[model samples]
Target: MSGRRSPGDGGLYWDEKRGRWIASLTVGYTAGGRRIVKKASGKSKTEAKNKLKEIIRDYEDGLALTSSNETVAEAVRYWLEHGLKGRGDSTVILYTGFANNHVIPAIGARKLKDLSVEDIDRWLAGKARQLSTRSLKIIYSILNRSMRNAIVRDKVKRNIVALCEIPDGCEGRVSKALNLNQAETVLSSAEQADARIGGYIILSLMTGARTEELRKLSWSHVVAFDAEREVWLPVTETGWNHTDYAVYVWRSVRQGGDTKTAKSRRTLKLPQHAVEALRRLWEHEGLDKTDDCAGLGERLVFTTKNGTALSAGNVRRDFRKVIAKAGLTAAEWTPKELRTASCPCCRTPVSPSSRSHAWSATAIRRSPRPSTASRSTP
Candidate 1:
């Protein structure tokens, strides 16, 4: 009797160079009439044949096996190059930095198709010992997003990262608000600063506006009169004449130029300090030299000497200078922390009632001050 033959069984042979059993099969043919072969190798004939059977089953299920050799690093680079179109420059820089500094250096040489859940779990576990929870989350997101993109492009069949749990990492930095004394020192230092940065610091601290929003503030948004009431005011009015001065926080530096949230897009009544700072800025920059007080040319409030928008790095460097002059360690301060410092100066805590009429308090409190124990003389 002839030996029994199973349907779709491939030929098995010994591979002398690899010293292993090899199973080879003709799964299909290319459009050009070329044979498409699939092979599996193992220590024994039974192992090789079993792997071949699994590969044949996958082939019959209509899954493509073309990206078996793609590496994790290549996949990440592809995603970073193609997936982040139209993202803000800062965002792209940040994402790319994380991918190169963390993800690519760790397991980027692994084959994308061969990546396993255990491999991901072990990699994350190792990272947890050195990275912060926030950083780990970011890297995990990068890998997850890259793998998903690869799957869409048929570079890989599955995202092994999705099957792995993120291990707990180290604690991130804690954010703190400046006490009253610190706020006073910063404001005082700003008073003696250049008009551009001084105005930015005053407006940010007094109005509690975000640094991003301040970066996008335009000269047109600053109001100084009430057209309806036909009255000349020291500050700009928004919608009505309830306040002498105000600013429209309708935009930010984010992609699409929208505020961080709908609640962040309200009108802010300028405090006396902010109004004086803006007046000094206008005179110092000769902004009133133009006839269009409404700033029809779309002039940015804060910019470099060459009229270009200031980068975040430029603003941070300038802010650090001011902080250092204020007798504070520049390393511990950031431009965004000004908003936190302004919270205590609010007449009322941020609430729904305060948000509807004005986004922040009209006046900053100057009493109940704390001693300047931590302040240093510059």
Candidate 2:
């Protein structure tokens, strides 16, 4: 019965088809100049008007309305394309694989605004049954990051993934160490291999250096310390001579050539066997005379015959061949296990607290083969 309300006051009308009141308002215009209208329906005029007022208040409060048709897959794709700047290539590849293989195929079709905590929970639980715990964490991180990016872009109001808990997933691979006999066999087999493989195996097994660190080792980082001692000479009273060799584990193949951790950047004294193997490798490669090995000691210690860095796949394939020659199952071994094997080669018993320091000292003292007992004089 009231006079027609002004345009700014909004419009309320009866919908006889559905037997409810409808309220409508134009909040703004789209990029193409199309009117963007907001609508609300209720059983009574007051109820519909209240709903419209709530929407208007939200808009005035800076809440951008998202399209109901925008989907999780679109959000994820947008983040993958725009949000991954400065990330490493391997990391981007891994994230893309998880999204395409696991996330996108599952709940990616769900509307971004309509996605619920229950939906995320169910998806994670299903993934827990098949993927490892580490893998589950990676996928969850991807979803959480994507949703955050969507929120910043006004694609969604909130990130529902923040409310979901990550569940425990399938077990990951277990690492094992070689025993004394196995270590001896591996060393012996490595000694018979090509100079590069033999030197890499000995250095890795004896020094507990990571494969990644070894891959980035440069000749400049190799140092020889000279020891001074007093000698009974007619004219000279002292003599200085080289007593020890050490290698600086200061770089890795990771981005920016940074080690995995600050603690990983250390100087390790080379054991006798390791020094011998390195010497053989240097002579075999003719590094002493090659112009490539001139003033710049930055040349990599381990590489192909053509002086190029070896790929991970190439190293793994060559390592498996060495393992097979040692009479061990190649399927059960990896280059990383050599670090674990170094722990047991220590001659002295190591306390759990001082394992790191004691293990290196032990490796220096003990040889690959068992020592023979000395016979007492009669």
Candidate 3:
């Protein structure tokens, strides 16, 4: 027999500087007659040879063995840079924050190709001790998606993350839904507060509108039925004198001013309290004084005195004040919880199953407001 075992069989040798066994082979020759060599290294000949077999097997199965020696950090950065190309700025910011603060610090130094299911499992398990399950899932997705895209560009052979399951993490903050009594108190307190916040709270708690949706409300969307004209006109056209009123829940503070979903686009009839609150806001705004009621159509319904859109921080701060005034722990509540309690408190006017005052029998009246700014309605 010849010294070489076979033409297609691989060769094994020891690397002097590396002090490891190398399994090397020629898979093909380029058009220029240059030999294309592939390699896999290990501390022992048996380990190197077994890895070489896998590489050869994969190559024969039509997978290219051109993986780079990239680190987890590089892979993650690549995904963060390119993977989220069309995502919203807020979404990108959220993922970037999680990746920097959690994912990279944990396993950024590890080799992408060498990452294993055990590695991912262990990493997620460690994170579970410190993060909430939602946080853990987010970080896991960052790694998992990074490795998956890496495979598309031949950076790695497989994604071990897909094989690993996310472990349960610490408990996250849960939304606290108010019972009937609590809901009543919050509504009453809100009405007694500033008219702007009163309208905000009344609309939020009574209509079950999301905070984003409410913040994006415009005067044009606040429509009132014109009994004579038999058409819905903007609040600016009809003012608050009309009895039948509704709000077009067609916009939100999302990136493009879109509702959360197609189904989220809706029309909500104003409850008695919500109408009172908005009527108070209209008078408090004094657009009629400016004789610019026509121009108020495009103006946002809820905004700061400076006419800027209400931010999440702004809503939270004002909401806490109302909660505190209602004799509840301000720090423990958020604006979203009102949505949960609003479901039954508000019913569609036309729905046969509608029940009146399901949450509070106490009607919401226009609480007296004290503004330094002169009010024309005063």
**Clash totals for all models, in order?**
5, 0, 0
TM-score of each: 0.80, 0.75, 0.77
Clashes by residue pair, model 1: 223-236, 224-235, 224-236, 235-245, 236-245
Model 3 residue pairs with clashes: none
Residues 1-378, model 2: lDDT tens digits: 789988766778999999999888788899999998878789988899898787677677777655456788998898899999998876788899999999999989998888999999999999999999999999999899999998888788778799999999998788789888898789889999999999998888877888988999877666554233221110011111244456767788887878888777666766556767787888887765555543436778899878898777767889999999999999889998888884545323323322333225233322222112211110
By summed lDDT, which 10 consecutive residues of candidate 3 come out lowest?
369-378
- The total of clashing pairs for model 3 equals 0
Q: lDDT values of the candidates?
A: 0.75, 0.75, 0.79
Candidate 3: Cα lDDT at 105: 92
Candidate 2 achieves a global lDDT of: 0.75
TM-score for predicted model 2 compared with the true structure: 0.75
Evaluated at residue 143, the lDDT of candidate 1 is 96
Off by over 4 Å in 2: 1-54, 60-62, 226-243, 304-306, 343-378
Which residues of candidate 3, in runs, are more than 4 Å off?
A: 1-55, 172-175, 254-258, 261-263, 342-378
Which clashing pairs does model 2 show? none
